[model samples]
Target: MNKCYIDGSIGQCGHSSRSADKAAASGTVMDLKKDFHMNSGAGDNSYARNSKIQGLIISKSQSERRKAAVAAYLGTGRPATMSVADLGCSSGPTALLAVEDIMVAVERACVELHGQPPEFNLLLNDLYGNDFNALFRSFPEFNSRRQGKGLCFVTGVPGTFYGRLFAAKSLHLVCSSSSLHWLSQMPEELQQKEGSPAACVNKGKVFISAGSPPCVAEAYRKQFHRDFTTFLRCRAEEIVRGGLMVLAFMSRKNREAALMEDRYIWGLLEDALNAMASEERIDSFDAPFYAPSMEELEEEIGGEGSFCIRSSDQFLVRWDDDNQYSGTGGEANVTARPVKHAVRMAKGVRAVAESMLRSHFGEGFGMDDLFCRYGGLLAQYYADSEAAVTNVVISLVRK
Candidate 1:
């Protein structure tokens, strides 16, 4: 079939149209919806199990999420029916974790007003390749805990968030956590074919790293602006005027952090890959990700013009290093913790990034060796470095 829709107005599917849109690309030659899922399943190294880091990030903004949900509920006059969405909702506990936060907040508001909560139309969105089965299999436990929240209906809408997914002004509250940094597609300049004159060789790196030319970072910055603006525009159409929107994602505090500094995640991965295979031998790959600064986010929100920033916050979360977890650092560090933590962190990064890595490098490439070496590099650097990521969460309202 050429078209598919759920609950009457999800989205129409068409490849010809997709190939025609061209606002972006994912690295080189990859359909993000097809190649971009986190490692699926309930395996030991799965994203489901390795997502505690993201959960911690989400918890940091729990208060704001609730406030946004309640504001949307009240701003919409607390209608008999309410619609909310968690965009970029890759599969795992974190997916439901976000939905639960909004549900709890809105329910508490209803209780305060001595009114019955509206029917909760909770939409879960992500790329099509995501494992919705695993997400839903974990639902009974979630539903059991969700009692007294409201009559909630969950629908999985698989598509890119950079484009519109819902009908006009249909959503009351739109919340996305740990997801916005993913661009809709790779920067056009970076994706040029090998022999093409304008091709940008961000050579020997998965992302903009220590030796990347300034143009590499600039291309990424411009792409982030374009995709983020598109994201805001699409959401504005789906969310009612004055509806609340909350977003939490990885970010940087300044230019140094944005430059990869050898302490960044992707930079560390590049080191591992370079050690495994010489830099010249490494595949020509670019990751479809970017971490924007706080100022950049505010500028985009204002420039997009559809959403006004109601509030925003920036916080730091340490990498999941064992020494930090055990309160051991520098000389007192439990040497074993770093090793184990390195492997654990390696798995966590793999779960989220392996799909893109595999797609770019192909099935025959050695993933185990990559992460193993990556763990070593991570351990070495994080042992003596703060190496924390700046998470920026913004609360927005349709204008």
Candidate 2:
């Protein structure tokens, strides 16, 4: 719903908020757009309150983002008004948290160059159903933090990242954190009917577990390949030559690490559901998520033929790591107090995944019962294995 035109007709990115809300409420909303957003407000269970892990991912990627600002400033010769976008910027404090870092970096860079800082035309992009209202409400807080930084005009662009959301050569820099693993929708192969020979019926599991057929994993890889390739191509067109991008997402070092993550994260959901209901829900459900290897990403970028990698990193985030903001538990907390860890992990999972789970099962599904089981599973998963998830952040410059 962004007023941005692919033919390069320019307008103020100002109308995006009003248009975003309208599109979100439309009767013809896409399946994933309607159910893919995080919990919308600042309540106890809201994404704003429970997204500490996502915030940490952003924090961990600070150096890359900082590097990006300077690289983009220099690469593009420091235009007077730089246009930047944050894709899949779901509604939360962390959303603006990313922008703040970029702003400070650019401002500092300008100072270092002994030049006037460029004003920013900042765009926040997400699916139609994203809670842009909450983001606007929190804008003042972000504005308060912008003292002495360049001017910023922030707006929302509502749409999926699978396709074009901006005009050609319209962007100077782009960034997304903790978002790329999500497939645009369920893989076409997995959605086939249960008894069909071609269907990936994932019999007793909800995701790619250790016992999954090789076909299931292949389906995931194929979808990620398709989606990520399309993503690079679209961004290539929108970004000015030499513009930079910083993307941070859940990733795997290889297939072995992939299974280890699946076992710890989605595996807990599988165990909880199996214990709560029969195998019926488990068999019928599949998470629309895939964590790719760094090689997989490199291959796609190379094939896309638009951007060259500048830098890449693999950061390991511990499951038991305690976050003061989230009140979530880590190894030390698990030993001192276990119940908090369960609550932490369960609430965090529910914040992001509950919407899709409820939509798949039923609106009236027992969230309490399921998450309770999920918490118990988390405690046990930690007791059994050294749990951590791999996150990869890559910096690229448009060719």
Candidate 3:
């Protein structure tokens, strides 16, 4: 994990591998340190890879809905000075698409502004440990796109949007996608059930049971609540009297029967580990993590004093053949199981599996292979299962 953190140059500005090398040499593990998490090392390029394959499909759809919501919130003859922020902005390539979208929206909104569009301030906020390398690599293109416009790019400020990444009453437009689900912290109390003797075997493994306790489940829910409510209040403080916010994120369904089960990808990965346990392959497996459902989000945000739902919906994204498991369709069998789990695990939770493969499995294990296998397994899972469609976007706005 330290090596992976070192390899990605996590938690710095720009794509200079020098920072990562220096950190590696210094033996500094930023991901495990006091103030840093969400580094590309911790999160991996999953979002980057998924964006290329998905191409703002759900995000763009949610963006369109958000555009309408923003327009409706602002109405006609809106002010000229507008500022927007994309919280949890990952790499440059993924972040750039939304910038382009926002620019187009600004231009379109300007036509109604009687010739002058709002002087827009677009902020890209993410953890300091993010992969700015990709962003720096694409800087030239971004500058060229804003040749004559007054757009600004800034980095590393206070607040974890999970809490409050910005100041009060300060923004006209704020956008985030596929990011809000991450909790500020993981649960510490949930131990594996007694049937699990392997739970006592290794200190390295801090495992959770397949059937998580109410407190464990509620921990994530409460974290989202605390982070989101504070986020809304902070945005409310920064937003003008009637400014707008456009948010799109992965949301689950609210029904018990229809609710996504562990058989779903996240849970299934944990289950697969449990399967390995039955075969005594490993001691125990930890449960998977996920974002809130649309209902949960709406309920949480609506209950918060600062925001009201302008518009929100759930939509599906089907898997396409082009985004299939690499050039081959399930040609790789034994290696297939680890592919999806590995990529999902890239955010740096399950380190033991990663280490074993590289040092013990003799399988030439690396990040790329882990990511590809992850993507392929996901593609295959979506292909085979009937209930495994990707979460739909939940669009929201400030009251």
Candidate 4:
């Protein structure tokens, strides 16, 4: 059996080259449930520590999250009990933040209507390998600090949100953050085929970049469309009619996926890897990520026909948006700031991509040196201007 590293974790690779065709024949192909998860635990490179930027992105979408939760509950006639699911709830301080916020929104809505606040059945969903144990360990503190009135039963559901994970009409609200940009599997066209010289068409780059072939971008777009359509169909089956879903994920302002802001970071990594091309680090390695355009998203949602868009908007997040740097105006300070920012950036990327890197390039591939070079490259790239990442926040209602 083949293995794949997703989000810095090892898992069995159940995806085959004909995964799309197999899905058409058997109703399902790839089983991503067993793969994909952020680096677990609270170690230095753990996602728990390096995910502050993700928290900030989630914070920026608070207004929409609250509105969606309230609207979904109100539309349900303020049921005495409600079911809510937070998809892709990785282990971290921010894991329960959304759950707590949604609870508060529902309670407030119920109060306004002079009805009793409903008991909540909150399900936190993520890949099977996620550090759910750590998430559950923090639940006691989260429950104690929560400011809402009502019984909240929280359970960790280990599975992929790309497929149906809940019973029909069982969910009142579904939310996901900093996810969805990941395809269910690597694009088949980009996969390294045995004995095929042109197997790795996207050589030297971990993701879409300026030098990637036109076909590379098409494969990524198609994979995203397939995964996203499956996601919508699964959610449509689970969520009650009129229920709401608020999804926020990385996006690109440009219609072309290769021209996105964050893609530059990957491009920098590609340069660093190419510097060590003799070590073969760039051989047959591709990051299974795609930041889509608003048009692509609109097209997929429209084609899915299971949901109606309530609101859609895009926002910009700076590379150092979490205020990780504090440098006074001075030549010395200016020179030092980018280096520090680059280190932070590398840590963030490692927290999410290290497993894949290690898996693809042997364990002895000098990852430390690779990232050091990557950091320096990013520092130089950002010296000329501030870096910004685009994100799209969409709220939808089940039709």
Candidate 5:
């Protein structure tokens, strides 16, 4: 177990005044490899079961993904064997969907140019603790469905995408969906400040929100800038010239990070925690996440100078789009009831955040109670407003 600093003496921000002293007293380094991952298995709380929202994200980016694959194959003169990678491919049915989409695009390009499809080497990457076993269980079905049309080999590579995960000029195409918004780690400057009135700099919040201090937003922005730059630099070294990358992740339309819909979800969660008298549990717990604007993303890519943007677009996603609690009566009636909406929201949030919550709050914290409160909060919020979340999808080519 990693050492947790939730003793009210430390903060979630990485740069507390007494951070040096605290670190010296307890030698612990944040290990994202061990910390980050979707909840494992096909259980009710598992990411695999509740990732329909991510699937929707993948569906929306299909055109971009296909275009990138085709461009990559044609640009490379239809390599006999194409190398492809999906970074942050968490465990779920959707894990292999991107691979399949790429295969279809490449195969179509091959038929249009050559007579047949090229052999494919597909790599699925995620954090080390990801539920890869469950991910692999779907491969046989995937292979069988392929019907021997193309010789494709699928493998899992566990590690952070913020660093180099493949050899130099080894990859022809790279894609990521519903990821990248996740920072490699929390911003070091956001750590809890000693002798501060509040336990954390970003009090009562796990992520940047309208209520967050300007310094909190700046910290997140800096962390994202650094991490995204490193990500592009690493990919630039690994991808061959003319290779393509399609990235689709959550983003805010507004320049101000606090006004984003994504941050409101965390605000609601914070409310739930506070209601449970466990606000202190999240005192030193900053979520390693950020939803960048299109401008921010373009700036990073341009500054990196390794890739040129081919196309970019933003889309809105409603929270109730994938409501699983719809009864046989009708969609409108089901969504009208607060309980059903709350249940769906709870499951979706729990799937992605259970690991982080568990790690930060420890086992003694009542997960059921916390999510119940969260669900109620979500219910009330949705009852009053029907806002949609925003996401940006960008296609790029190595220069």
Candidate 6:
């Protein structure tokens, strides 16, 4: 399996490669049948694994919701045999969890279908760059689970989910979690905007200042819309009629909230990078794409014709902190430092941000600075013990 797909054509959410004729990177929108080579970018499944851990530590609500969505779909007059796909299956941890939850849900739904459970074909897909070795590491366990129940098959197929990786109307349910934010590679135009608003930054943070030229902002927004819409269209084709898809990902709040609080996080990163650069710890700077606000996400979804939104919910991630603080003012509001367990928690946050940074900037840039700065910001943000509702989960059924 190729890890990343390099094609500049912006599909849905600007992630999938529609054509490799142009320059690009992993997660481009294209016909599943189209001949193309896979790269390692999509194969970076560590984040997916980390996400699974984070999901458990932060929010299990979505897991329950996803299970219910599958059950609801099966309750319909669908066939006993169902095909399911996990778009960004990555290594196997998260994939397995999602598949198991789905299977469990299907089994519960089958109470009304008949006495026996539904025969299922579950496809676990990731970019070719994925660690197939690690992914297969769990196969023994998966096979063991298969012996006692309904006929079931699980396979690892490497590819981006942006395109139609499955047969048209072949999938009964599709679930992609914490993925789908990547647009088709990076925009060539955005890439070339060296000194423009699209590339503006202050205090090592990346942001569009009020002085940013309108064209750069518009260009970026256009690219995002085009890519996001294409993503929906491709997924629409892969889902069977009446099929259900529950996708959960990071999303920002309103512009005001994003700028005053969220934008500062990026700035904190800039401060970190500047510190690193000043100390010669790193050579350059890069910024990652982030969770779109509810408004932005809704706008994109509303424009797409492929799926109908059934339910949308926003929730806060429960930071794994006890709300302890130290110092008078400097670190006074910060969550009293994490424990040994926080070693993993800290790494997980760094991993997601690193992925975004590498995609935007290039390699050779370390995230230590970014991590430190954002760590403080996050600690401070959660200091008041306020509910940090920063994520949005949306469930959709094929139109």
Candidate maximizing lDDT = 5
RMSD of each: 10.2, 11.2, 9.6, 7.9, 7.3, 10.4
Pairs in clash, predicted candidate 5:
11-192, 12-284, 13-190, 13-191, 14-188, 14-190, 14-191, 15-188
**Tens digits of per-residue lDDT for model 4, 51-108:** 8878888888889999999999987777778899999999988898887889888888
Model 6 C-alpha RMSD vs. true structure (Å) is 10.4
TM-score of each: 0.87, 0.87, 0.66, 0.87, 0.88, 0.70
lDDT of 5 by residue, 1-399 (tens): 111112111112221121122212121334667866888999878898888878888988899899989999888777889999999999888899888999998888777765678899999999998999999998888889899588998889999998889999999999999989988887878765455444368777777866778888889999999999999999999999999999999998988776666676788887666554344545566788899999989899999899999999999876556654444577667455554555666777788887766666654556666676676666677766654678999999999
Q: What's model 3's overall lDDT?
A: 0.48
Q: State which candidate, 2 or 3, has the greater lDDT.
A: 2
Is 3 or 4 the stronger prediction by TM-score?
4
Sliding window of 10 residues with minimal summed lDDT for model 1: 1-10
True-vs-predicted CA distance for residue 369, candidate 3, Å: 8.7
lDDT of 2 by residue, 62-115 (tens): 999999988997899888998989998988778887777888899888888799
Task: Summarize candidate 6's per-residue lDDT along 1-399 as a digit string, tens digits.
Answer: 111111211111121222211222232222222222222133432454445443552244456455545643654345677787877665545557676677777776667556567788888876665666776777888778766767777777776665667777777887776666554543334442435454332223244333334553454456567767877888788777677877776566665323423344445455434443332112222232445667777778888877777777766564443332233445522333332223334445455555445443334443443444444444444445442336667777787
Model-by-model lDDT, in order?
0.76, 0.76, 0.48, 0.77, 0.78, 0.53
Error of 5 at 176 (Å): 0.6
Off by over 4 Å in 2: 1-30, 193-200, 256-262, 278-280, 319-338
Model 3, range 310-397, lDDT digits (tens) per residue?
Answer: 6666665533323443445565643443333333333322321232222221223233433333333343454455422345554444
Q: Write the per-residue lDDT of candidate 1 for residues 1-399, one digit (tens) a residue.
A: 122222212233222221221222333566676888888987876898788778888888899888998998998888788899999888878888887888888888888899998888989999999999998888889988976556888899999998999999899999999889888777767775555774547877768877788788888888998999899889988999879899998887776434543237788788766654433334356678888887888888888889888889988876552233565566544554455556666788889988876665555556666666677666676666755677888999998
Which whole-number lDDT from 0 to 100 does residue 92 have in model 2? 79
